[model samples]
Target: MIFFDRVSKVYPDGSVALQNVTLTIEPKEFVSIVGQSGAGKTTLLKMLLAEEIPTDGQVFFESSDVHDLGKNEMNELRRKIGMVFQDYRLISGKTVYENIAFTMEAAGKTDEEIEQDVPHVLELVDLSSKIWNFPKELSGGEKQRVAIARALVNQPDVLVADEPTGNLDPVNTYDIVQILKRINDIGTTVILTTHNKGIIDSLGKRVIVMEKGKIIRDDKQGKYFI
Candidate 1:
């Protein structure tokens, strides 16, 4: 389980990004976090990855405090989480296969493992036919699929998608949402941060509403209400 024990974050300029926020995410649960810009959604995720230090309290993954981990321990912890972003951060020069393989290689997977797992993840995202295509040759949705495939190649325990469909058309957005649902159904915990009300309403999962860095509401099987 992931826990934020009264976590708060204040920047160097004394701007409060998060204020006394506490949250818990259980394994295999799909949760969506909705808020306007600067509502502290991204800051919350950063704390999970230890990219930002909390001003008070602690963030814990399982039993270990995320902020107190040593370098190697932190690296191991991060290996179990995958991240997707609004802009599909793919290498322009590399083929889809290479892009996914790069992640496995970094984790010290064997060549045989990369060869085996890359195609599996691509198939999961329905991008098997575009394995050799470069990012420039694909559509926006396909690029994001590639990004998702890259993120999942390692089979992370948690998938964090931040505005993944922000750049896609309605059709592409639906496709991506379906893919996310499928990923969740397969048992990986999904934590999504998005402004698309339609997506949020369609999900009908747990909704976490945040305002001014404080969680205002949390509902099981909730809709999009700001």
Candidate 2:
């Protein structure tokens, strides 16, 4: 389970990024968070990853307080979470296979494991045929698929996608959303932050709406309502 207990973040400049926000995300659940820009969506994800420290309260993953972990402990904790972003952060110089393999290598997986798992994830993203292609050679949607494959190669417990389909066309956006749904169906917890109303309405999953750094609404089966 992931829990944010009355968390608040105030930057050094005294800007409030989050204020008294409390949320709970159960395991294997698919949750969507929607709000306008600066509504604290990114800040909330950063807090969970320990990229941003909260001014008050705590963020917990399962039973561990995320901010209280040691260096090695934090690294272990981070391995349980995978992140996908709006920009497909693929390495320009690496092939699709290499991009995914790099993540496994960093996690200390052996060469044999990398060879086996890389193709499996690429297959999951339907990009096996493009394994040798570089990021420059793939289309935007394909690149995002590769990004998703890289994020999932390690099989993290939670997958956080922040505006994942922001740059795609309508057809591509629908494909990306379907891919996200398939990932959730496989029992990986998914936390998605998006502005696409069509995607949100089609999901019919738990939706949490935020504004001014506070949760304004939470619905069991929700649409995109600001």
Candidate 3:
């Protein structure tokens, strides 16, 4: 569903975030990207999202070159990719329902659609009862769940989770991982970048390990090796 063809990114001041990274992510596949800090894991995700233009090579999403798209085209393409971050990134004033509703609202969804889909996605993240709560009221796990629900509100073809479990305890991390797995089981392509060794080993899925801005290892049914 996504391809990075010899992509490289060099920052101003002579820094390289990625170096000739080539990868293919199949549809409905759950892929984990594991690496230490500054290993280029996040850069790969940025390339997919077209958030950073590669200094060389191309990035393709379902056959369309992402870097070649215009503003409006990029906007349209981005609607098909959902992103979850290490930080919850929720609006402090928005209720759980409103936080999820905000994305749909931005997409020009109607009140009826928002009414129907918001509750469904909340249920998917197992936070149906917290719909009325604010961000400050939830635990770290709950906040991340809300972030996941917000990301899924659009029903994107691929979900990119960048360190989604970074701030939670083991039990909460397990819960979040299970939620991600459930989403993948239902056919959403999941791209997760995490630092947790236990999360990687427990996944037992395809793993791509990065080092010094390059892909060092790619394994199917892989475990934590970094």
Candidate 4:
């Protein structure tokens, strides 16, 4: 579903984040990228989501080269892609219900549709009871769950999470992973970047390791080999 051909990203100051990294992720598959900081993991995800243009090589979504898209076209592509960040980028002032609801509303979903869809997705993330709480009132895990619900409310075809479980305790981390797995089961392609050893060990899926801005290893049923 996603392809990178000889992708390399170098910052303006001559620092390399990704070096000629080539990889592919099939539809409905869960691919985890394991790497230490400065290994270009985020550079890979950002390129896929059009947040950054690769300094060299190409990034393709399905059949189209993303770098060739216009601003108008990229917006359409973003709607099909969902991103979860290490920080729960929630609007602290908004209630959990409004947090998820506003996403569909912003996309021009009707009031009725928002009301119907919001509750359904909240249940999916097991946040039904916490729907009325504000970000400050909820626990770390609860806040992250709210973020996940918001990401899925758009019914995105691909889910890209960058260090999603970084701030949570083990119990919360486990919960978040389970929710991600459930979403993946429903056929959304999942691309995750994490430094957590246990998750990479247990998942046993495809692992792409990047070092000094280059893909050094690519393996199926991959391990956390640095």
Candidate 5:
């Protein structure tokens, strides 16, 4: 339930991040975006998150104009979307449980709710035993799993994962992909941007290929071909 209409983004120093890019992501769909660096994938995700304003067009999330929203309204819109990054942005001092609980607390979830949901989500990511572990105490895969759990704690309608497997080994990468697929099967829309061709090929999902700020190919059940 997202739409981009003739969207373009031009930075102040004359760099174009996106040009006439138009795309739509339906509810409960798993879509993968693939391209080299500077292909505007990050800009597209930022536009959806309302972190970047389009230079010449509009972005809509389920019929609401994302760029037109006020500050409070934008925050409300963002609550419906969750983001996971490559770096595993977890708090160094917080334990696995606390990291997720912190996100729930910010979302106004009560202590009881956090207690119940945190363990459930950790179980979903297969990180139940690591509840008391700190970020530095975990492996890269465990850290990424914690990040995924944190992102899912709020149960957002869409999950945007940007290069989530970039830092992990192959086995960990495969595990993360399977976890994402499981999330999608449960009805959350997933938008993934990755450079790994084998991952894209194994996914066998809708693929969008971008080059120099434009979508050059969009294929259903697509491969990793550039």
Candidate 6:
């Protein structure tokens, strides 16, 4: 579960990306964050991962305040939450297998565990066939699937995807969406931020709409009202 209490983000240049926002997301919920280009969606995601600190208010993950955590504690917190982006942030030099294994290694898992975990997640994303291939060789959809596998390999508590389908065609976008939904089916909290109206409308779940830095609507079984 996640909660934000009157959170706001103000940059040094006198701009605010989010203002006085408060929201809650329960466990195992699939939520979509919809907004225009200048909305605060990306800023909100950054705050959740402690990539940026709030100027006011708080961020809580499973009832624990992330800002209150120590260095070692933050590292541990990170293992429980995985993030994906539009770019598919895979290391160019590492093969698909190593890319997925890198996550477990950073979390300090042993080699035996890595050997067990990597194959299963790759299979989960249906990318087991391309395990030894590097990022340069995969298509956009394949890279995204690889990203999903990496995010889920550590058995994260939540998966935060920001514009996950930004670069793909309709078919590839649908493919990624199905994979995300499948991940949610197994109980991980899924937070998706996308501009694709068709995908958002089809989801028919909790949808939060933001504009000019404020959350204007939060609805269950929501429509794409933005």
For model 6, how does the per-residue alpha-carbon lDDT over 1-226 read when each residue is reduced to its tens digit?
7999999999999899999999999999999999999799999999999999999999999878999999999998989988899999999999999998999999999999999989999888888999999999999999999999999999999999999999999999998999999999999999999999999989889999999999999999999998
Over 160-207, each residue of candidate 1 has an lDDT whose tens digit, in order, gives: 998899899999999999999998999999999999999999999999
lDDT of 3 by residue, 1-226 (tens): 7999999999998998999999999999999999999999998998899988999999999989999999888987888898899998999999999999999998889999999999999998889999999999999999999999998999999999999999999999999999999999989999999999999998899999999999999999999988
Q: Which residue ranges in model 6 land beyond 4 Å of their true spot?
A: none
Task: Spell out the clash pairs found in candidate 4.
Answer: 17-213, 18-213, 19-213
Candidate 4 local lDDT, 60-156, one digit each (tens)? 9998899999988888788788889999899988999988887887677999999899999999988899989899999888888998999899999
Which number leads on TM-score? 6
Q: Please give the distance, in angstroms, between residue 194's alpha carbon in candidate 2 and its true position after superposition.
A: 0.3
Clashes of each: 0, 0, 0, 3, 0, 0
Q: Candidates' lDDT values, in order? A: 0.93, 0.94, 0.94, 0.89, 0.94, 0.94
**lDDT per residue (tens digit) for residues 62-140 in model 2:** 9999999999988887878988989999999999999999888878899999999999998888889999999999999
lDDT of 3: 0.94
Listed in order, each prediction's TM-score against the native is: 0.97, 0.97, 0.97, 0.96, 0.97, 0.98
How good is model 5 by TM-score? 0.97
